[model samples]
Target chain A: MYAELTRRSAWHDVLPTVLGYIGIGVAFGIVSRAAGLSILVTLATSTFVYAGSAQFVLVTMLVEHSPLLSIVLSVFLVNARMMLMSTTLSTYFKQEPLWKNILLGTFLTDESFALGMNKLNYTDRKLNFTWFNTVNLASYLTWIVGTALGAMLGSLITDPTKFGFGFAVTAMFIGLLYLQIISDKTISLKLQLTIILFVLILTYFGMAFIPGNLLILVVTLLGCALGVILKHAHN
Target chain B: MPTIKFIFWTIFCTGLATWLTRITPFVLLKKFTLPPAVIEFLNFVPITIMAALWFQQIFIQQSGQLPAIDYLNLCASLPTVISAVISKNLLVIVVVGIISAAFFNIVL
Candidate 1:
């Protein structure tokens, strides 16, 4: 069943994420410091809150004097997609022990979940705990450390975009999407490309009307549904 | 600095909310049994999610009218795609993309 799963070492699957998290983590730290968050608070946020965008929103909304309830709502809305991801991830992790699933769930971020799914899904990668935890713990620890470094380096490294750090996450996504399509022989190249085009069009059209978080859910549901329908028809 | 109580509260609430969204589904759904079709559908989620995230980053939305393309990102994507196709390596594509960003940033 897992013949194609262990093609590469765990480090190979995780290095890009580890590197990108460090860079983004630094940026997050710098932003928190600039927003007047103390180093302890910054560490606590990254350690406890963990979700990158939500942490950024928490910092911004706090600065903007949004009420605590509103901040919680905003954070919830921003991270609602994680609910979908966590559900999808459960398809794989459901068999694990309760504590393991909970621990894995705690560490599941957008990057780890997406990367794991890309391989574990269309391709047959056996995502063992050893491998999965390596990706999660390494990325998590580095993110915390990187935020600490960025908080300390605050003024020295202003304007992270100057070094092109801004594009690292996007670049990683692009690369992963490319790999996801290219490696999967389960579906035809034509259908994979068609699905990509279909999802892009849906996202593009929905951008102006729908909110980012909700729009993603809508597009993902519609796009993947159509993809499955087309695949069945193709068969 | 913001007041200590405020910081602690925000951190506690935001962290809790984020954790729930992230952890609840696994805890909640693991108990139930899903049908096969739904499982098949979940397989398709990753690609669409990836595409959505890529789109949001690639194009910057203007409050009104069509969204404008970030030309720098567009230009950098060419090399990144090429590296993805050629090397099939994450490190290679990301490095290519970052380098492309630096190069385009200087020129554009």
Candidate 2:
């Protein structure tokens, strides 16, 4: 159904990101392994879970034995934003078969989506399933290699604190948030700050009294509410 | 701690749910468009949840006492947040955070 992709052309667009992908992929693998996941499991997670921040969230939730539904739901909700990417790409992929479009969607990620959109808008190169899928495949291979290397190294480094990994998940979240802020540009910094401040205070004060699980829901709702309220007020 | 079976299932299910989020929208985009308010809310989720997760990490919960601050994490977070503002890159933020954490732990 798809044309044969030129690796040279695809790699041209994907070259800059290969190092970044391998670096972060290594971190994810090491953190998951040091958290007590087996090498096989870590590899499975990198292969299937796919999303970076989502995998970090999974490591924490799974280790805590959080309710199964909650884990799936949280990941679903966090990643649901990717739907916007799929929607955008669907426009570009409409010429292809439904199965091929879905297959492309399965491999879509924040980086690849941005890359695809960037190519479509600015460049003369034809953006097609073949090119996009090749980009994804190259990145995926490097990511898997990085993960395997880290998993092997992780066996020697159990307690990550001494190596400064005690707050890796939290740091990852901050990075994720900041990255979103720059990319979307629709939401004002003022609104983001207001919601963040509210969540920070709410979580801190509620921690002494509220259960962690319940607190997560309450904060998420109120934070989202604050965002919507502030946004509408401006409009 | 969960059983190996439970972990596998969680991974498998999460993978499916995540993939579905990305895949179904391609098929559904023509038939449905999320309302502006819902889109706004969905956009805020990553922000709100990230803030919550960051808080959970930096604060240590005590049974009777109010939450205690994780000094090491707190120290590292300052630079990480700054890097977030200045760099706005995930890898940069993470690397800065890791370095700050390691530096402080060694000195203090």
Distance from true location, Cα of A87 in model 1, Å: 1.5
Q: For model 1, how does the per-residue alpha-carbon lDDT over A1-235 read when each residue is reduced to its tens digit?
A: 1224443555677788776787789999999999888889989999999988778888998888888998888888878878888888887777788788888888888888877866665445556666666677878998999899899998787777667777788788898888888776666779878888998787777777777557777888888898889989978
Please report how far candidate 1 places residue A156 from its true position, in Å.
1.1
DockQ of 2: 0.46
Instruction: Please report the candidate that would top TM-score against the real structure.
Output: 1
Worst 10 residues of 1 chain A by lDDT: A1-10
Across all candidates, what is each one's fraction of true contacts kept? 0.69, 0.68
Task: Categorize the docking of model 1.
Answer: medium
Best candidate (score: DockQ): 1
TM-scores of all models?
0.93, 0.63
Model 1 clash pairs are none
Error of 1 at A5 (Å): 7.6
lDDT of 2: 0.74
Task: State in Å the error of residue A117, model 2.
Answer: 12
What fraction of the genuine interface contacts, i.e. the true contacts, does candidate 1 reproduce? 0.69
- Give each model's whole-structure lDDT: 0.80, 0.74
Docking class of 2: acceptable
Give candidate 2 regions above 4 Å deviation.
Answer: A1-38, A51-143, A165-185, A206-218, B1-14, B43-46, B61-66, B84-92
**Leading candidate by lDDT:** 1
